[model samples]
Target chain A: MNTAALHKNESTKPAPATVNQYTFTPRVDIRETENGYNLEVEMPGVDKDGIDVNLEDGVLTILGRVQPDNQDGFEKAYAEYEVGNYERQFQISEIIDEEQIEASVKNGILTLELPKHAAAKPKRIEVKVG
Target chain B: MYSLERHLFNQLSGLNSLINGLPGGTTFAAPEGRSRRDEFPRLNIWKNDNAVVLTAEVPGVDPADIDLNITSDKIGISGELPSRNRAEGEAYQRLERSSGKFQRQVDLPFRIDTEKVSAECRNGVLKVRLQRAEADKPRKIAVKAA
Candidate 1:
C-alpha cells in the first residue's frame, strides 16, 4: 500500500504514550493465552542473518541491524528516513519456562514463545463437602 | 601508563553521551516485567521486477494470530495478539515490546494479478508475493519482412 497512507494510518491509531525522542524503533504487539504468552515485533528492514535474540537477567532482548544495499560509493541524492539497528527488551516473571522459551525469525518478524512452567498452569479445584 | 588510559576512557564515556551517539535514533530499549504475551509486530514491502514482495514481522505471534486480505490493488493485514498485564509487585526495569492493534495497508505500485498474490506464514514471518497483471506486462511484437 502507498506507505504514505500507512503512515497516516499509524497516526489514526492510538499513539504510544510517549514518542521516541530519537530512534528507528519497531512497533510491537503483545498477547496472552491460557498456556503462555507470545511477543511479536516488527522489524521492516532487518534480516535473519542480522538479528540477535538474547536473554539476560530475566530480560529477553531482540536486536538486529538494518542496512540496505550499499551505494557503491555513490551518495544518495535525497533521503528522508534512516535505516539503523533495532533493539527491544522485555522483563518476564516466573510464569515462563526459562529453559523452554523459544524464538524464531522469518520475513522480519520475530516470534518468542515464553511457555509457563508445568506447575504454573491453572488447575480446577475439586470441592467436596460433608 | 596503561592505568592512565583506562582512567581517560572512563572520563570519555561520560563526556561523549550525546556527541558519539546515534543522531535522531537510539538503540532500541524493550520494556520490562510483562511476560510471555507481550510482543512487537511489523510489516514490510519491496518492489521487484515482476512482483512486489511484502513481509510482515510477527515475533512470538502465532500464524493463527494473523489475517491477510487482498484485492486487485489493495492488501490489508490484521491480527489480535493476546495481552497479559504485568504481575503485581514486579518492577519493570524497561519495556520496549509493544502490544495492541497492528495493521498495515499497502497499495500496489502497479496493477497486480490479484488471483496470484500468494501468501504464507512460517517461522513468524508472513510473506506475500504479488505478481503483475498480464495486461500490464510489456509484450514483444513480431516483424515480418515482405
Candidate 2:
C-alpha cells in the first residue's frame, strides 16, 4: 500500500458523513453441478430480514443491508471499515429451473441452489447390439 | 514528573496533527493500485473514555477457524475461509469471494488491559473490545477547599 498517496488524498475530501451509506458489490462464487448450479454470496453483517432476493424476467437480483453497530454513546474516533449495502444481479438462461430455485442465508453467506430443467439434464443413451 | 512527560508527548502529537492536517495527509496508505476498502475483512475502530472497539466483516468463515491474539500495544486477527464449492462433478463458473488464509494486525496508541478484553462473533461480524490500561485512563483530581 502506498502511504504517501493516502496522505495526499486526506486533504482533498471533506469529512465523511456521521452515518455513511453506500453500496458495494458482494463477492460471489458460482459453481456448476451435475444436478444444477450453486451460488454463494458473501454478505457479512446482514441479517435475514435485511436481505431480499428476487428473480424476474430471467434476471436474479440480490440486495442486502447491514445495520450499524450498536454502541452506547461511543463516538467513532477512528474507522477503516464502512458499513454499506450489497447488490448484485445475474442473468439466468433457459437451462436453469428458476421455479425450483432454493435460497438460504447463514453466517452472512447466501446460498442459492438452482436445479436444472428436466429436459436440460444429461441422459446416457443405451445402444443394443444384435 | 508524569505531567511533564505527558506534556512532551502532547506536544509531539500536536505536531503530528499539524502535519496530518495537510490536504490528503490523513488518508490511510493503501496499496498502489488498490484502495484500503478493498482489503478483505475490513476493520472499523472506535474508542471511548474506557475502551476501544474493533470490528471486522468476515462472512462465510467458521468461528472455529478464527484466531485472535491481543497484547498491551497491539492486536492480531487471523483466520482461514474454506472454499464452499464442494459438489461431485462440479466446476466453478465465477468465483470472486476470497478463500484461504487472512490476517490483520493493528497497533494501539495506548496500552490496553488484556484481562478486560472480550470478543464476540455473530452474523459474520467479529467485535473486540479492549479496556484502557490503568495509566492510560482519564481521571479527575478532586479539588480540596483551601
Candidate 3:
C-alpha cells in the first residue's frame, strides 16, 4: 500500500499551558486498509473523559490526561514508568476525508479511522472482450 | 531473599527520585543489565504502614486473559494480548504497540496476606491492593511497670 497520504510528525513541542509534570509521547500503530487508515494509540490510565482529539490545518493532534494516583501517606516502594499526560501529532494529506474521521477509546487504546476521499479509492478496471 | 528484594526496591525508588529532581526534566537511562524491553509491563508500587498498592499499564489486554499469583513476598502477573484482526488488503504502516504474551514479577518489602489481595483492571491499567499479613505487621509493645 502506498503510504504517502499520512505520516507521523516526529518532533514534539511542549504544550503551551500545562502543570508541573512530564508529557509523554504515546506509542501508536497505524494500518492501511482498502477503505482508509486505522490508528491505534496507547494511553494507559487515561479515561474517555480525559482525551482530546483535534484536527486543524491538516494536522491531527491527540492529548490524554491521567489523574494522579492518591498517595497521601504512602511511600514509593518501586518505580519503573512515570505517570503523566500523553501527546502526539500526525500530518494528514488531502487524500483523506477530513470530515469523515472517526475516533473511539477503549481499554486505554484510542482507535481512529481515517476514511479516504471517494475519488482516492482504487477502482477495479474490468477488461471487455470484443 | 526477601531482604535482597527489599534492598533492590529501595535503590530503584532512590533512582526515581533522582530522575524527578534533575533539571530540564531529563529522563534517566534504565539500570544496568535490565533494559526496558525485558520488563514487559512496567510497575509502580506504593506502601503505607499496613498495605501496598501496585499498578501496571497493560493496554489492549482483556481482563480475563490476565493471570496473577501472590505469595508471601512476591506478586506475579502474566497475560496475553490478543492481536487485532485484519481483513484482506490491509497492511501495516507503522507498528509499535506490542502484543502476545507478557510476564512480570514484583517483590514486596513485607509479607502479604494472600487471602486479602484484590486486583482490578480499568482503562488498561491494572491495580493490585495487598494487605500486609497480620503476623507481619509491627505491633505496639506496652511496657509494664517493673
The TM-score, computed over Cα atoms with residue i paired to residue i, of candidate 1 is 0.45
Q: Chain A TM-scores, all candidates?
A: 0.68, 0.77, 0.85
**Tens-place lDDT digits, model 2, residues A1-130:** 2222321121223333435555555667667777787888777888888888887877777777776677776777656655666666666666778789998888788889989899878798989896
Candidates' DockQ values?
0.08, 0.25, 0.28
User: For each candidate, how many residue pairs have backbone atoms clashing (under 3 Å)?
Assistant: 41, 10, 0
Best by TM-score: 3
Runs in model 2 deviating more than 4 A are A1-20, A127-130, B1-34, B84-88, B142-146
| Error in Å for residue B134 of model 2 | 1.7
Assess the local accuracy of residue B130 in candidate 2 as a C-alpha lDDT between 0 and 100.
Answer: 89
By DockQ, the best candidate is: 3
| iRMSD for every model | 14.0, 14.2, 11.9
Cα lDDT tens digits for candidate 1, A1-130: 1111111011212222334312344545444544666665566556677677777666666666653533332333222233445665555566678789777776556667778788877688999996
Q: Model 2, range B14-105, lDDT digits (tens) per residue? A: 42110111112223323243356556667777888878888888888887788998999898899998856466666665556777889988
Q: Rate the local accuracy (lDDT) of all candidates.
A: 0.53, 0.69, 0.72
Model 2 reaches what TM-score against the true structure? 0.76
TM-score of each: 0.45, 0.76, 0.81
DockQ of candidate 3 against the true complex: 0.28
Docking class of 3: acceptable
